[model samples]
Target: MIAVPASAAGDGRPAEERGAAGRPSLWNIANVLTMMRLLLVPVFVLLMFADGGYDPAWRSLAWAAFAIAMITDLFDGELARRRDIVTDFGKIADPIADKAIMGAALLSLSLLGDLPWWVTVVILARELGITALRFWVLRHGVIPASRGGKLKTLTQGIAVGMYILVLTGPLATMRWWLMAAAVVLTVGTGLDYIRQAVVLRRAGLSAAEAERDRER
Candidate 1:
């Protein structure tokens, strides 16, 4: 019997990498954008807390930094896919950079007393927990991000951006509703991810057992 390479056998490498002969460089635009987002996390935090943590001008600066980071995130993955430059570095760092920027924003807002501590804790817990779950089941299979997950991320970004800005009367109330929607999406999508991971792990284990039986 001929042996297949692990990559070709889909032993946890991304589908795109299977049967591919060439590797992309780590210095591609996608990775650069991800790194930029990671760097902006600290800048956003500093600007968020500047001037007693409530100055409109400083908040605006922080919001600009955040907006830029989000924009880069939107572009980076598409660029990587279209250009066939999806490096392993990009796959790992992109998600970390995303969580870092959003985590910093949520935590900073809570510390400043702008957002409720519970909101921050819940969002952060979901984000971190999902990430850890991905790694936990990584050897089994890669869970592709669902459309609902993308929607959840979009809602989170917009809601968090609204909270970052100083608003008045009706706008403030609207932001609250938006944030409520974000929380709902966060929890809902997190549960969905967990379900997918469990299914993937079970399928992978069953497949491995079948292969062992065949070998014996």
Candidate 2:
């Protein structure tokens, strides 16, 4: 009698099954949520500018849309990581969705004279620069989110929400303060991510050299 090897037995399964086990599905719940966030961007912009930022009803609807979109950002990431359904599509689409929503809100506010253009320029520069930096360092390693990065997101969300709601009096003053805090946090975290990229590149080089030494 002849004995078949276990490896050969496993290889006898269909290619589709093997691929499914090794790679994440693109049409999972997490990716759907990310796509939904992207879809919400235009809706948010339309609602925000429908009445020239004057009518309370339109402003309220815009705020609701923005809030829902932000909530999805939180859950989509959590679900992806928890369910082990992370994918390259999710990695690329997630940040684009986030920046799109925030950018729409900031640009609308500036155009309506609610926010200064300078604020929009600074925040956007940081976001786009960091995004480019991430792609540049892909050969090295991923930079995980730090506590400061999370704080910056939170503060920026709150500031944008307040701005969309178009609050007046004391609430208006509070929004400026929140935005100031967000700006500080955003700049600090941007610098930190650049530093982390340098460290990760050096570590990757060291590991590669050590592997060569072992092979020799």
Candidate 3:
């Protein structure tokens, strides 16, 4: 009888098989949902600007598209983690889609004079800066989304949806309040992520030093 390799006999499977088992497929339900969100961005913009952003019916349609896109964001991450279908593409593309949708909405509103340009500028600046920082430290480690980050996203979505509805009087005032909260959370979470990056960098340096010592 032919003898099995000792390593294979102990684990009953080759290393490649184990690695393949843990690797996620690129074309999964979660990634599909993410792609759907990205596709809806242009649709949202078209609907918003179809009637110069003044028509009530077009605004309603725009809001519907934006709401659906936000819902996809909520589910895509959950589905990826639960189904074990998380991939590098999903991690990178998911946040990009989120930023694109929000940026489009904010910029469109500012252009239409529905929202202040300052607000748009501040929020977009924070988002793009943090995105760049994430990639900068990618070699050292990843900064996962914190609880505050999720809350910021939720608040931003609610505030933008409210603005898209173009509410009047009391509801309009409420929208401003919601936006204020979102801005606070956005800035606060951004600072937290910067701190996390510093910690991760230090940890990576420590790991490298320990490895070098062991080698010596």
lDDT of each: 0.89, 0.87, 0.88
Question: Candidate 1 local accuracy as lDDT?
Answer: 0.89
What tens-digit string does per-residue lDDT give for candidate 1 at 21-95?
A: 646667667778889999999999999999899999999999999999999999999988887778778888998
lDDT of each residue in 1-216, candidate 3, tens digit only? 999765546443224323343455677778888999999999999999996788889999999999999999999999878765678889989999999999999999999999999999989999999999888888888899899998999999999999998689999999999999999998999999999988998998999999999999
lDDT by residue for model 2 (31-128), tens = 88999989999998889888677677898899998998899999998987776677889989999999999999899889889889988999999999
Q: Which stretches of candidate 1 lie over 4 Å from their true place?
A: 1-23
Error of 2 at 40 (Å): 0.5
> Top model by lDDT, which number?
1
Quality of model 3 by C-alpha lDDT: 0.88
TM-score of 2: 0.84
Query: Runs in model 3 with CA error above 4 Å?
Result: 1-25
Model 3, position 98, has a per-residue lDDT of 91
TM-score of each candidate? Answer: 0.88, 0.84, 0.85
Q: List the residue pairs that clash in candidate 3.
A: none
- What's the CA error at residue 55 for candidate 1, in Å? 0.4
